[model samples]
Target: MDRLTPLSKPDPVVTLDEVKANLRITHSEEDVLLARLIASATASLDGRDGALGRALMPQRWRLERDQFCYGIEMPLPPLLSVQAVRYLDAAGIEWDLDLTDVVIVGTDPAVLRARTIWPTVLAEPGAVAIEFTAGYLQVPEPIRTAIIRSVGSLYVNREAAAGAAALDFSGLDPYRQWAFG
Candidate 1:
């Protein structure tokens, strides 16, 4: 693994209005603070468990690999599509691999398999670049509820006692990604 860069991020799963309503905030006094918290919480959740909630919104990511292999597993889950696969040769020239040569194998942490030819890459870091899209168009109810609960908890418990847990994410366990070795 070299670099996993986000080309585009999905629209926020929870809107400002929805969060405000959940917080029962009628005024705009804390709108900025709430908005910041919402973004922070969403990002935290998005990256949690290897981007479990990424399916709630379609996002594009660029994955850079140090070398080319027969199969490559993307870092994120719920892969929507592979945009392109390009590699840098030993001569420092870049070439695009045929899209038809690549196949998506699994859903959770989608795996890409090379069909006929696997290109040789430079013997350096970031020698291969794969751009792909993942995530969902609509947010799930459970995930939305979890976000709301987390935002509300953070808002209410901005100043929690030492050693106290601020938010309860137990409800999100069902939707969370569990890794198996």
Candidate 2:
């Protein structure tokens, strides 16, 4: 799975104003630096877990498979909706699968289950495409806090220090997806 739409604005996990407040800055001198740090921190946290937390903003993701498996697990969490599912037939004709044939289950890395059976696809890489949107309309409190702290930490420590204390990410660890089996 790959994110087709890289983080563009309309919504950011943490805004510039929010970051500035976290850093306790009242001036705009380092606005550019703060913005970059916020983006970097958000990207770092977003990719930390395989499938945990919401996107915090609407974004597109594409899941590709070599064939129509019995069950396909989505790669992102808190899925808001499944946009489309397109497949390449044996004859090399691309077709969109009917919504009735697919069922979405669970919010964390939403699972896509085939109703009866999965259709055949052209035997090749990425023969099936699943496009979906995952995220929250507003960033959750814990996630928002994590982003704020991370930006502050990154700003304070521009470079790694050999003996410096590690940035506490324990607050964010609970939000990660852990495998039990």
Candidate 3:
């Protein structure tokens, strides 16, 4: 896998229509794919790595920029989360916890776990503006518990994903009561 931060080319620019076509909305009943696509494309850079993955991953792709710091990442999963952490552990990362972003693998029966056993990011004031790719979430306590155990963290319950489009961003808080409410 290649580092995602440093790029031979810019992050893939996605269109509203493109994301819309492939969008499986979870929270809102309106079109919000463009926002997600934009966020994903932006987050795919290495510039954001210094602060995000500085201490977590030992050897990271390094770069300097005025607008944004860049770092190349080995493509792992939907997020730089638990899935990547698990892979990194096997690939020789010399760490027990990542404590970064939520590790989200896929949209299907997707797995979500906190990157760190005890999140340094979550404790910080403005670590990351959390977002769920598959959107809405409403899993059973058992499943949530399993995921929490995977990352040595806890679950932040969320609504379920939608079909047509999204009205707004959901899963922004630990409580899933009013993201799109």
Most accurate candidate by TM-score:
1
The lDDT per prediction is: 0.76, 0.70, 0.28
Would you list the clashing residue pairs of candidate 2? 55-135
Error of 3 at 98 (Å): 42
RMSD of 1: 2.8
Candidate 1 residue-wise lDDT, 118-152, digit = tens: 87778988999999887866667887777788789
lDDT of 1 at 178: 62
Candidate 2, residues 45-106, lDDT tens digits: the string is: 56323234335566766667777766676654667788889999999999999988899988
TM-score (all chains, Cα) for each model: 0.85, 0.83, 0.19
Pairs that collide in candidate 1 are: 55-136
What value of lDDT does candidate 2 attain over all alpha carbons? Answer: 0.70
Of candidates 3 and 1, the better by TM-score: 1
Better of 2 and 3 by TM-score: 2
In model 3, the Cα lDDT at residue 124 comes to 23
Q: Write the per-residue lDDT of candidate 3 for residues 35-123, one digit (tens) a residue.
A: 54344332322133311221111122222111101222222212332223322122333333342544544532334455444223222
